[model samples]
Every structure is written in C-alpha cells, then in structure tokens.
Target: MQTRTNTFIAITSLFIALGCNQHKESVEPKNGGATEKTIEPTNKVVLSSDIVWQKLNPARGDQSPQAGTIWGNRNGKVATGFLAKFTDGFSSPPHIHNVTYRAVVLKGTIHNDDPKAEHMWMTPGSFWTQPQGEAHITSAKGDENIAYVEIDHGPYLVKPTDKAFDNGERPINIDASNVVWLNYEKSEWLAKDSKAEISFLWKSHTDDALQGVFVKLPKRFNGKLHSTGNIFHAVVVQGGLDYTLPQTNEIKALDIGSYFTSSDRALHSIANTSDKETILYIRTNGSLNIDNK
Candidate 1:
C-alpha cells in the first residue's frame, strides 16, 4: 500500500513539473527560451504644415531655393520627400536628377520644358514624373510663388547637363482634372464598404518600388484597417481626416498640408470626419500590398 501511495505521488509530481515547464515555454518570447520583452522600432511620424514651414531652407548647394524635407533623410539611400517653393518667374537651365522623382504641384503654375520635346504647363494639383537621366528645365509662371511636393529615392541633387538634350523620351505629366478616379469600393485591395476614390499618378516603369496616388475620401468615410509592408508618405492636399495608429492607440487630426509617414508593415486607418471631401497625395516606397484585416 505504501508503494502504491509513493507511486501515485511521484506520478502527480511528474505531471505538475511538466505542466510548469510548458507554461514557462508558452509565456516566453521565443520557443523554449527565457522570457524577454520585444522592442519594436518607431516607424510612424507626423509632420504638420507648421513644422514643415519651419524646416524650410534654401536647397542645399543650390542658389537660394526654398525647400523643406517632409520625411526620411535626403542624404540616405532610403526614399525621401521635399516641399519645394520656386520664386516667381523662376526658371532652371537644362538639368537632370540622379534618381527619378515624382512631383505634385501644390500651388501656382509650373511650366516644364524639354528642349528636345514638347512643353507642358502644369497648374496646381498637376502630377508629373521625371525619369532619372532625363534632362529637362522647369519654370514658375504667374505672380505668386509656386510650390510642389517631390518624393524620390537617394540624394536630391541637380546635375546640370549640356544644352544638347535627348529627344528619346518625354516626361510624364498629367493634369489632376484629366485623371480618372476609380471607386475604391470596386478595388480588390480595399474594403468592400469603402467609399474612397483613387487617382493613380505614376508607377515606376522598372518596378513597383515607386508609386504615387491621389486618394479622395468623402465625408464620414471610414477606410479599411490595412497594412502594407512599404513605407508610405502622405500629404493632405485638401480637407481633413482623422488618422488612427492602431499600435499606439493615438489619433491625429490631419488638416490640409499635413504630412505623415508610416513605417513598413504598420497598421493604421483613416476617417474623413469633416463635411468636405479629403484629398491625400500618397507616395509609397516599395510595392504596396494591402492586407484586408
């Protein structure tokens, strides 16, 4: 009887020890490893218009050109953004950028001329893409200063090319009014109930690494809580929206001219709570993949 009792106790203790070990493993950050806290990198940032205005400075190495960086270090290999303001009647001699760039005209008129090709006069809300190694000249018309937002990868340097330019290809320029808006409800990537509209601006010819879109959300519209494994830089072109950062549980009211950047794979949502439609100029680095949840 004593042997039977000893056996029962031993079996019970063995089970208890096994259960404790399993519990410890389950609570640990890694499988069968010691418990550790995971630290996530800060991947979200907001840049209000006021902040951008304060950061405005003359373009580095350029002769007195007003500009401000929105996000990412322009000197780094990652994608970067800048808000450039041109003086009235400003014109540039034929030049080229080392890296391709996409631009959205925020205010005033911009006249783009390629000596070897046709000229395009772009007004506010116009979108254009300047391919790398393509030489072109830019000029600002009208009495008011012209402003535009430029997004690109690598350093922002202006290389002066010879007056002799190539007529091989022309820059892609699209007026905002001429762009066709596609309903977000019909898109396979968006939530079925979403009431937003999107106007695609430009997609890189080489790959999906660079792309730009103009999104318009009606009042009281709620976007899907989506995540893309690409860094997104967005600027509020008109109206306002309430942006929610799911991980931090923080809400921010993005007014016109407000800018924000989301780290790769960060989950977030936007809602147009105002009475007017909210327009956002969104640019992404890397391919944009939408997660339903």
Candidate 2:
C-alpha cells in the first residue's frame, strides 16, 4: 500500500485545471447613482444535463454508443472523465481502444471482458479496467445503461482487434460486492466517529501518480474534502449531496454525474443530508484530509 498519510497531504489531480468564474451581480450602493457590481465565482461544475453528447466512435456513427464528457476532452491528449451510455441489450463487436481506461458502472449493468469470455454482468458500483490496446467487447443490459469512464491521457480511439497489443497491464472486473473497504477507524481521512468508508481503485504509474478512490458517506453525513492539491476532480458516482466551496455557502446538487474540478487548494464542503449513503469518486495527485462534521 503506497498510501500517503494525509495528516495535513492525497488523491490524483486531473490532466488540467479547468474553471471559469465570470458570474456578475448587482447591488444598490447607498450613495451611488448606479448600482454596484460584484463578481461571483461559479464553481467549476459540469452536470450531466449540460454535457454535450458525442459518438463514442465517430466512424461507427449512430452504430456507436453515446459519450458525455464531464472533464477534459477524450478526443484530445489529456486525462478525461466521461459518461458512456448504452442502449439496453447493446453489445459491441470485438474492438480495442488506443488507451487504457478505468470505468465504474453507475446505472443498470455492464459486461466488459474478452470477446470470447462469457458474460459477467457488473451492476452499479462495480469497477473495471481495460489495458491499452486490449481486445474486448462491451455489453450492456437493462433500459438505462450508463458508466463513468476515465483515462490518464487520451485521444481515446476504437481500433480493430488486429491492432490489439499488450501494455503489460491486465484487466480487472470487480463486482461491487467484491470491493474491499477501509472504514473510518482504519482510514486517516474520515472522522473516527463517523461511519464512512473508503476504497482505492487505481494509482497512476508516474512518480506523482494520481489515485482513483471512492469515499462513501453515511446518511446525513457532513464533511469537507480538505486537500492542498491544485488540480482535482470529484464526481458523484452514487447517491447525491450538496457541494459548497470555501468562503461560499451556496450549495449545489452534487448528484450523480454532477462534478466539479479545481486548480487551487480546495476546501470543499459536502453533505449527504438525505437518508441514503452517498459515494464520491475522487481523482487527485495528492492526498486529502476530511474535516468530519
């Protein structure tokens, strides 16, 4: 375990730090002829409803599934996170992508394995990885099939099976129930008194490798993902919560598929005030300290 003890440090940051805060506000000035103006920082947020869908394979045209990007650009050479939606009973012919990627099933069920492998359905919360140039077939079941896919860097492209070549990394398909977790008592981030848990999914191969992790919040749980990293990405993979930034109380729905990125030290307050648990999938190059409340 290469866990970085975040007494003060952790997760992986994204490929780029993207944010724009051009919000403007007007207010009455006591002794001014015109109202005073103020600018508000609209946190870097990308919602599913706002995502621009594109064909996963432009060449395949309508024959391909849809991809909705959350952060970065899959067509560009940079780390990216996006959603893949497949129609029910959808299955792809044998194919390979140019880059290795990590994926998490968010809705319905997905089966991603070798072309000749038997179907192994993975339900919501399941995690899987596809090595670069690995030949595989992706199949989906149920009416609403969606999964969160991420890449370390891209120009993500689908290629014919003959182009497949080993990158030395093997594929892993872990059912949700098979996930091993570290409870609050064992983790350094969560409050020892809280019932939250965390699970690490992957870590990049670079010296300052980014980490992909899942943090599960108990019902009504409130906390902050206090971290010093300048580049980070947090996506709601399960359930929902209110996300607020430092010096700002304007909380917004951090529901599934709604994500926010940051390029500076972040003190993001999150709360799962609902009755159900909420899970956040965070990627960063540094560690985090949870301010349990």
* Residue 72 Cα positional deviation in candidate 2, in Å, after optimal superposition: 0.8
lDDT of each: 0.58, 0.72
lDDT string for model 1 (1-293, tens) is 00111233333443333222322112211222111221343346464555444223345333345666777666677677777777677777778777767777776778664645444567766766676666777777666544545645687667778533343444566665655565534343333455666665555565645556676778777654333435577788767888775557688888765776656544446778778887778776432222222
Candidate 1 residue runs with Cα over 4 Å from true position: 1-43, 50-63, 115-120, 142-152, 163-169, 285-293
Q: TM-score, each model? A: 0.69, 0.82
lDDT, candidate 2, 96-206, per-residue tens? 899989999999999998888878888888888888888889999898898999998989888999998987877777778766666655555554475877777776678
Cα deviation of 228, candidate 1, in Å: 2.0
Instruction: Give the lDDT of residue 104 in candidate 2.
Output: 91
lDDT of 2 at 7: 10
On the 0 to 100 scale, the lDDT of residue 43 in model 1 is 43
Give the distance in Å from residue 293's predicted Cα in candidate 2 to where it truly belongs.
1.9
**Which candidate should be chosen as best, given lDDT against the real structure?**
2
By TM-score, how accurate is candidate 2? 0.82
